[model samples]
Target: MLPALLRRLPRRHRASFFRRRMGAPGDLRRFLAIIMMIGCVFLLYMFWAQPTSPTSVPLQTFVPVVTSKDSNTHYAKIDFRWTWTCENKRCVRKESTETGVHVSLTTCSMLCGSSMLWPQPTGPTTLGSHSVSFDREQLTFETTATEPARSYIQYSFAMFNSNVANLIQLQKNEPSATPQRDFNKFIVKVFVEHSDIVKLTLSTDESYKLILRMEGENMIGTVTANNFFGARHGLETLSQLIWWDEFASGAGSLKIVKGASVQDAPKFAYRGLMIDTARNFLPVESLKRVLVGMAANKLNVFHWHVSDSQSFPLVLPSVPQLAKYGSYSPDMVYTASEVKDLVEYARLRGIRVVIEVDVPAHVGNGWTWGPAEGLGELVMCVNVQPWSLYCGEPPCGQINPDNPHVYDVLEKIYRDIIELTGESEIFHIGGDEVNLECWQQFRNRTNPYVDLFDVWGNFTVEALKRVTKANGGKRPKHVMIWSSNLTKRPYLTKFLNKTEVLIQAWGGSDWTETPELVSSGYNVIISHVDAWYLDCGYGRWRENGGAACDPYRPWQTVYMHRPWNGDPVYRKSVLGAEACLWTEQADHVSLDTRLWPRAAAFAERVWSDVGTKSIYKQEQLSIEDVYARIQMQRERMIKRGLKNEALWPQWCSQNPGMCL
Candidate 1:
């Protein structure tokens, strides 16, 4: 058909028609050819410039820059809502409508809304409604401290450097955490008033003021403190203020309050948490984790119940036989360097490692090497049959104070503790739960005229003297002794001196001992077993287990425990408190769960003494409000690599008001 048409046309016309039909002539053809040539060049250049992998593609192609109209709606009123929710049994992002359990796009972040912070920072404090977003990479810590304080400042800075990326809960694609074309820097300027101070003591001021403001190009965070210790607390508070905003700029990112102020100080100087490593030795890593958790809550004291009847994991070179014979195994021992390193680790985090070697009573397994090396009866009735007859629990052992050599052993132990921890100002002489029957048996058989009570009282006196001698002949400013028979009434007067001893009450708030100890002018650390003991509540460990301190002390019990709720004069004897976690039924496997959330409750009780509507106003907030704060803290701990137990069901957290 085409040939017939072509034949019908003239030869000259046919050639012209062919060119026009097949390609187009002159300028029209030139335009089409130029377009194709440009397309080919673009394809070739793209292939050459880009690697084989497709990752180099700009983020803008997928995520458009969210302007005022396109910004993610975090709440109906505010630009952002910073609540939280549960995920994988820990608090992850409180969940946006899509990724979390909000169940709808309207659930505002209520987790940090009222509480805003944990361990409830004491007032004058205020939380604002506006928000500011930033790249955590820009987070910087600059300190005005000099010399020794600078060491701690650097340590805290390094910790943030190694950890700021993890502060936000990043996930697959984690696009929000990616480098952004639009993000601001955050600078933390710390002004320490006492820059020359570096020591961490019970009396050390852990008070700090944190002021946050949005400057021209960066979010300026100012921390003013009396020393490095307080400055470190301010850092922890700063970390708390930043959170993952799942609904930021239509893409999840980290955001902090644009304006905020916190003038905070621990209510008590002796805010502490005690972990017994004797029953079960915790490795350096585990103890470091403890320090991290303590730092998070502003707890300053690490009362290391280092050795007890079960084991003496601390290897003292002067008394090598203690660890050789007493440790669960040689491999499970804490060497001198390990102790020093751990002490430094705690110190850097603003925590004092107060080493405690429980004296006469809890001194069994660790002292069995006496006669083997010419030290006569260093410990009495070690692992004796019918253990309850001698000590409070199994594997009965007690230091034989009757033996003159025992004082020498105690002195060496004290000396090593002071050297290893560099903590000679305070010490815990574990003198709790002594079985008078054990002493009665030994003394009655030996000298019948010696009163068993007097022997116990005399043992206490001798131990303190040895400790004073060990501490360069200067008595510790505050010597800690557990609540025990010897600490009651006439015995207390005969053995312990009020000027020197700080009694740690561990019986129960209901007991008269708490009041009696304070009334007697002995500075007391309230650790009532019913309130502050974290190791209780797990039924029983033995075949016939039900201990006196059972039914588990929950976070509420800890929060409301104020044994010193009296006049200022009576309270004068009430030095802070320590939450005790005896590892009889707890170990590394359940360490975090046992202490946290609850220990944090104890922390607030002793730190701010406020778990209310407002730390400053001290308004009446419900237990539900307190629970919410704990939940937030628990999640923060999880993000920081702590394995805390669940505060409530995920359902309870997701639907906060409904659960209550």
Candidate 2:
């Protein structure tokens, strides 16, 4: 009892007691030093000797193998051989023939095992630094996990239901050489006695140092997903979805808020948000992060504007030179496989990607190709010097829509695009701004220069449709054109009368100022440019003039804009909203700042049941809350190497997103 009290006493007081008892100064000093050293060693030993975990569960990346009685394989025999340095610690393994097989290895230094046909085998697998072997019909795996044991015995049930061909294919496509980089590291060990219905005793542990053991009738051992990083968050997000097949949590069984049956689907069948890679190209990794953000917001459509007048991003198989002339870099084109990878990644997150090759007007090839050059008959020389800007010479460039050969060129390009993007039902024939001046200058040489509508705009619609439909595939379902067409009257009637085209009503929607196109029985996407455009960087009131004053929109403006203002009955025309970032003068430096935090609001507006308000008034609400969230998001963007810092200004107006 006296020793225990002394041990419990404060160390300084104990030392004082020692000093007082020792009397001699030098002897007391030496004795105190020795006592202090001994105390430290004892503490360190106490920590080190506190029983290292007895079991080691190694992560193994396993391929599914199937065999049936019809194949005359004798119960698929398995042989396992394991070699480990036990280091004087007892290494023991328990195995069984019943309930398939169970094996557990116990040792202080290392626990290692090799076994055959264990644990209801048809299930998912995890990969790590493990070695597995199979010969004749015998199988073996040899590995040792850490002392605290952080690994899993992922049971594979699909093996029983697979054919020989599937087995062969699975074997061929084994988990990556490094499984830790692929599947997350996890472990579970369970001990049961006698009856399957009753759990007499159970034990569980994790790398996070969480451990539990119990004896009960019904038992469940679950590891809450770590809010860690990388593929783990992806796994966690997927686990929360309704359709996740593997490890899907049953209703009320998992830690979910009760009374909340979130039977929700996306509002629009197609929620499209475009990134203009043509004007200001972004690297693949940058685009991938954007894709992840898109997934988070439930925005399904990735309208990748891969090409335009500025440059092309697709590597044309038929016309490789086109990419050379159009791309920013010598080889700046997305390979076929890369496009497939993007598609598959998007598909996993319930997103569909649509590629847009804005043709005829936007692809100003004539500017670079020059006149007298045979570029789909689109370039024309104003004078003797064919390529000159003006030489008493002809201004020789601009696509001549009247030419028959022009249609043939487009047809070839369309075929190539189709092959690259798989099969998209809608093709955006960008008929936005053909500036009549381009046609008026080179008019007589191309077509019968008739009325304002018929000569330039009307002709291209029919010609483009003809060429697009000529391909063997199904005719594209829809074509997207700017709302500028409605302002251009009889020409609008020409295309509107022919096919069902969706008009993107993006001129700026106002409660008082009604749009002629929206009222004219047209299915309109209410993408008002003032509110939703993300490309217009912050600090634009000074740089680009006040009328073009596009200070980066904060959260409130995005969330509160009402789609249907006038009448609820007529609101079906309000298909959905799209947040576009037109890269007129955008780069990686300022893109993420303007688009994010601001875009997060638009996402909430579209996905959540957040109520609405007048666009002007919405800017007045306290957006500071959203700004805090934005700061967090901005930090993430920066960490991911996004150019978000360029968006921050040295000083900003207190009421941002408000019109002065």
lDDT of 2 by residue, 45-71 (tens): 999987533122222212223353234
User: Ten consecutive residues with minimal summed lDDT in candidate 2?
Assistant: 198-207
Maximum-lDDT candidate: 1
Each candidate structure's TM-score, on Cα atoms with residue i matched to residue i, is: 0.82, 0.54
- Shift in Å, residue 652, candidate 2: 16
Q: RMSD (Cα, Å) of candidate 1?
A: 14.1
Candidate 1 Cα errors over 4 Å, as ranges: 1-107, 110-112, 173-183, 249-251, 444-446, 611-615
Per-candidate Cα lDDT values, in order, are 0.77, 0.44
When summed lDDT is taken over every stretch of 10 residues in candidate 1, the lowest stretch is: 98-107
Stretches off by above 4 angstroms in model 2 are 1-260, 365-376, 379-398, 446-449, 467-473, 486-488, 511-514, 537-549, 612-660
lDDT of 1 by residue, 489-586 (tens): 88899888899998888887788998888778888888888888888888778764358577888887888987776468655878888898989888
Candidate 1 whole-model C-alpha lDDT, 0 to 1: 0.77
